[model samples]
Target: MRYLKYFILVLPIVIALEAQAQEEDCAFKLREAQQLYDAGRIETIPEMLQACLERGFTQEDRLAAFKLIILCQIYADDLEKAHAGMLSFLKRYPEYELTTTDPVEFRFIFEKYRTRPILDIGAFAGVSLTHGLISQPFTPFNLNNAKPKYTSDGFGFQAGALFNFYASSNIQISLEPMYAQSNFQLVYEQEPIEGIATLDHHEKQSYLYIPLSGTYEFIIGKFRPYARLGFQLGLLFANNTSSSGIFEGPDEDNLENRNQLNYWVFGGGGFKYKLNKSYIFVDLRYNVGLNQYLVSPDKRFTQPNHNWVYMYQDSDFRLNSFMISVGYARSFFNPKRVN
Candidate 1:
């Protein structure tokens, strides 16, 4: 039993030492292959590096090996193998950018292939500020005698995923599906039979939204700045309201008098910082509501309990929102010829 315990502890160290030895052997072989290439032994270079390229080379070592092998095939007048080698190099390192130190022949071969991302899918979470655009005011009491004010009183949160399909190097079409929550407050003073009373009402709503957009991106160094224009469709899934001051009660579900479908048009711009094969991005957007959020006028007061017990009537308003979000995305690429 003691020997078994010791074996378990020693097993990992043994495997790690073996891996280190293999890596060192591969590194020595790679250096030898480079020297052979420099000495004009181009024909033997492929066989010299084949074993390490298949197994023990690290990521950086692998890139250097592929570059060296492709150059050797080019020098040997093996154009078919050279082209195939370039294709495999691109597939392995899709985000690689050519440097000035690269040979002119390498640049020529790289230019013959397209290595842009085919699609990028990611998720994001953020906060939003919502403003109500009131077209008409509603009150259980006489509007002539009382004044009501509506304000965005709280921050809302949202989370969603984006599906970005690239049409070209700088153009893409995107679909974003999100679940969002928002809040607003209403305050008013009314003259009751005995005295004046002040009331405050807070409403919270949750929705499912899908926005389809077209994006134009500017590739500037590692920062990609982009602008998007889109229209969104939203379905209200939950609505709850609570009141304070003179008329106060437990929170009540208020989805009955609210419109379920919301239409919006939004535009925004942001930048992304490339990190390896993934990107970290920040986005800002403003959504303009196309229609009122309340039900039709005749149906607004259909719930007698809402008016008599709660003494609350929803105002006819459109919701506009400004949102900021940060997210990460991984790009998938298909390397091929432009033709």
Candidate 2:
């Protein structure tokens, strides 16, 4: 039992030492291969480094090995093998960009391939500030003596995933499926038969939103600034209403007679900061509702509690919002020659 314990403790150290020794051997072999290449002995370089290239070398060492082998094949007039090696290198490091120190022959071969982003998958969470645009105002209690006002009450939250497809270097078409919540408040002074009073009503709603947009990007160094225009389709799934002040009612489920599906047109601009093949971005957008009327006029007085207890009625209005979000995205690429 004691021996078994000792063996367990020593096993990891033994494996680590063996790994270190193997790494040192691979490093020595790489240096030897480089020296052979310089001395005009390119014939044996590929065979000498094949084993280390497979598993023994670190990432940096593997890059050097691949470069050396490709250059060797190029010098030997083995253009087919050289091209194959370049393809492998690109598959291993898709985000690699050209540097001045690279050989002209390498640059020529690299230029033959295209490595643009094919897709980007990302997620974002943010806040929405919503306001109601009233087309017709209505009040059941005060027909002429009092006026009503609608205002955005508080911030609502939203989160979603982004599926962006690249059409070209500068254009991307994106579909965003999101879950969003919106809130607004209604306030008015009431002149009932007894005296003057104030009433307040707040509504909260949840929706499933799908937006399709096309974005144009201005690429400048590591910063990419972009503008997008799109339309969105939304389905209202849940809603709640609360009344307070002069006439207070219990919180009520208010989904009845509400428009289930809504449409919107939006425009926005933002920028992305690149990190290798990933990015951090900030986006700002404004959405305008296309459906002018949110509540059906025929069903306005159907909810008895809203009329008698809250002393309220539905107004013909549209919802508009401004949103700001921060997110991260990972890009994928398919490198191939444009034929």
Candidate 3:
């Protein structure tokens, strides 16, 4: 009985000693990490902190390391990475704090409401601009306008459904089919026909772009952001009846008059939300032209120069995009258990 009582008494002392040893070791490692940091040997700090974590440090230890990591990231001028790290740390140790310093208030502002769902589905309709070869002014067979201008900005209309299949809590696959139109007009802008800029006669061209893309998303609950890589196969649907007239020149100075279905790279990101099992979501994307529209050389009717350069100005390649459509999301996933 006496030995049994002694064993219990010694066991607690042993446990207390082991815990004290572990804390001392953790403090030692943190000091080492800070020394390395002061000496600008920063790459070794995470490794050191990770080692301490492997040894089961106190919550305070972990929190202090995280806060220091934030300061380090700030000094490194990597705001995006720093913000992401701060957010992630708060997720794992929501209440961790240090004895010497008060926790930053901003660190936990929206934490409780930040975590969100993994899958989403929805449909949306918005305006788009076909920054493609087909001009818009000559569209609808501009039997009216006789001139086109660079300022002949066009409009696009689109409607489609999108689905997000989250591969992981943090990664997702996106699939969507959207019907869209690119319409624009070619006209003379500043250099007027008689030294005056007017909405002169314009020719419009119209086409449809059906893009198939795969996207990788980086998720932080309701804030599901992503990057996409996809190809758009465009189809020529309408053009100016004036194509055979003023536009039908050699495929040189005027490719807009002779544009065909083309392809481009599509990529962009947006925020997401959930409404129920059947959620609606929104995202913004941009089409970057990969093919040259106008084959004209800057030699102005001269032969191709020795330098095989792309005619960007001749192609008039600019970003074509959609707006708030990027973040307007409505997901309807029956959250199994959000709390």
41 Cα displacement, candidate 1 (Å): 3.3
> What is residue 108's positional error in candidate 2, in angstroms?
2.1
| Cα TM-score per model | 0.86, 0.85, 0.42
What stretches of model 1 exceed 4 Å from their correct place?
1-18, 138-149, 188-195, 244-246, 301-312
lDDT at 98, model 1: 92
lDDT of 1 at 199: 67
What tens-digit string does per-residue lDDT give for candidate 2 at 106-179? Answer: 87888888777899999998999988887888778565665566678899989999999999889999998999
Q: Which one wins on TM-score?
A: 1
Candidate 2 residue-pair clash tally: 0
- TM-score, cand. 3: 0.42
lDDT of 1 by residue, 201-251 (tens): 788999999989999999988999999899999999999988754556888
Worst 10 residues of 2 by lDDT: 188-197
* RMSD per model, one decimal: 3.2, 3.2, 18.8
Model 3: lDDT to the true structure: 0.52
Kindly report which residue stretches of model 2 are placed more than 4 angstroms away from their true locations once superposed.
140-147, 188-195, 218-224, 273-277, 301-304, 307-309
